[model samples]
Target: MPTETSSLELVGVLDELTPEKEKYSDALKAAGEGFVEAYNIFQDADFVTKKGWKSELSKDDATVHSKNLSFGHVFALRTTLPVPIDIAFRESFLNFDDLATWSENITFSKTIAKLTDHVDVVHYANPDVAVVQSREFLVARIWRKVDDDIYVSARSVKLEHVPTAKGRTRGHLHLGCARFSPDPTDANKTTIDYLLSIDLKGLIPKAIVNLTMAKIILKDFTETKKHYANVLASENAQTHELEHHGV
Candidate 1:
């Protein structure tokens, strides 16, 4: 949501909001545990493309891999964006309320509650794909800076405020994490690693689910890369205008 390089300020806001921990203890705990689990998965080289993972999609420098887990099949994607890490972090993690505007797969997204500056209770829906039914998620999301990288983690949580909508199946997000880091070689580039596992709780066929899951994720990240490029171009144009006007 921030237009400037203010990720550190976001971290400060997280620290200042620590006093409210007691109020949202359950949600925070669930979200934090999800973060830790996701971080471990991201750090495990064997859990990624190297070991049991089967390559699902790989094109234009974006790659997705899948492996069977106890809860569901998990998908991990890695890609580089032509935008800085801060911008990628803001758009992908902080600005979820506006996700459906640019993301084609998501039909709607809303921030039900802001537990903290870095944590939120969010609800979002995806339209039916192929034989899969429309699915929705009620999740607790938290994002923070760890070391020099930014991580956003989300896990499904039951809340009275969010109930399943008519004709839509609820999806349990076992674990979802997105990591954003500087590309090292280019200041204007960022590398992102994403991991997700979800169980759509309904009478859907496993064959169809598996067939469509990887393609959906591939489209999601491909759209994300394009959206980030557009955002960066728009920002640069605005900066150029300001400089031309000597503002």
Candidate 2:
């Protein structure tokens, strides 16, 4: 019952609403390269140790590792979460903006631009902890899925449209990547490998930065695990109640 012109107008509206497929394609390519490099570094046992990646903390199934690079420090963590890969990937990357609500370490987070379904520009700020100063980062992120595994990579990028927030030191994230894969042994679990290279540009001492960084990564994973566990519990409870009522 729609007129030809009305249908055309509707198509135009949908076009505007949908992100351009080719937008930020070059950035996505670069991020892919970075991801490959990070994956290689993390997988190379010798290279990781050569880079001074020492085991900082090992608790339960989670292990945190750290190393010092010339430009900044790098941290890596591996853990298994009691959630499916798709849900873990969505919560960690697609729902990144929602992280501020559940993450106390991050005070502010906003997606500056979504270049495509797989690429975006984000700005997030972390509150000051101990001797560390308040810091913010503007990053370009790219994510992709291979088979059942999902990989996401991000790095600092300068965009004229997104200006620096006042009263916050802009930090440089050389590279950040997270890989989510279904645990082969457990169908309901996902294994995550998180690697990040960052330099909090300020007068903060290296010791303080390293300590805080380690704590932040560990806490982030723990919080994410706890959040999903609670969500699944609540969902199961609701489903049970509905089943009892024959809904």
Candidate 3:
């Protein structure tokens, strides 16, 4: 009994689809490109999700199938910074209390907040249901130290829902936590692992959901993984210099 008209609007809309699926392949490609660009800009940024409802076409009278459009998948990626156990304990423990300070001082925190705001604006303009959710501070519940390495786990969530006719819904839900630990084998190294499980439901096709999920994960993983690598490299370089100087 939902409206028949398309209630969802994509932040980045696809051009006209050709009758021939092959000819319309470009649409999918374009969507992929745009997703990557937007995702990179907003990932790790702090933001909020806003929700509301509006009327659309009556479901009973509509003839256009909702399947023809593309709504991207949902995913999550996390970065773990390697800190000495003592430092980790201090940082993780103080994260909550220092959240305000972190937001004011950390460059990444500011970047994340900006990204979330951008996503909100984009989603609002496009009209599809989209949300950006982030924790003010990293939550550390699980901590393990193997050899010289230390591992810590944290959690967060993001959800997007787009309602359609035919009792179908298209959206993305990303959940799970990330684990970060020092590299036992490397004295100057750290390892980070991010695990995210995805769930999609409603009248949407399984195939489409699966594909979008993959794309979302791929984009997020790549960007976050790269960020971690950069942080590790910087830490390693600093550690080496200190040793050389006998600090």
Best by TM-score: 1
Name the candidate that leads on lDDT.
1
| lDDT sort, best first | 1, 2, 3
What is the Cα-based lDDT of residue 97 in candidate 3?
37
lDDT of 2 by residue, 89-117 (tens): 87778998998988777888898777655
Candidate numbers sorted by TM-score from highest down: 1, 2, 3
The lowest-lDDT stretch of 10 consecutive residues in candidate 3 is 117-126
| Candidate 3 lDDT over residue span 1-247, tens digit each | 2121211124333222223323323223333334343333233233111012112112222111111112332233333344443444344322323423422222122111111111110110011222322212211122334344333322222212212223333232222223345556543343343333334444546665445444434444444434445645787899999999999
TM-score per candidate, chains pooled: 0.88, 0.81, 0.31
**Model 2 TM-score, 2 decimals:** 0.81
Candidate 3: residue 117 lDDT (0-100):
11
How far in Å is the alpha carbon of 16 misplaced in model 3?
54
Tell me the TM-score of model 1.
0.88
Give the per-residue lDDT of model 1 (tens digit) for 1-247. Answer: 3212212233344322344334455676678678777878888879645598888878788778888866578888888778999889888878888999999879999988787667788899988888787889989888878777898999998886568977788989988788998988898988888888888777778777766777777878987988898998899999999999999
Report per-prediction Cα RMSD to one decimal. Answer: 5.8, 7.6, 21.0
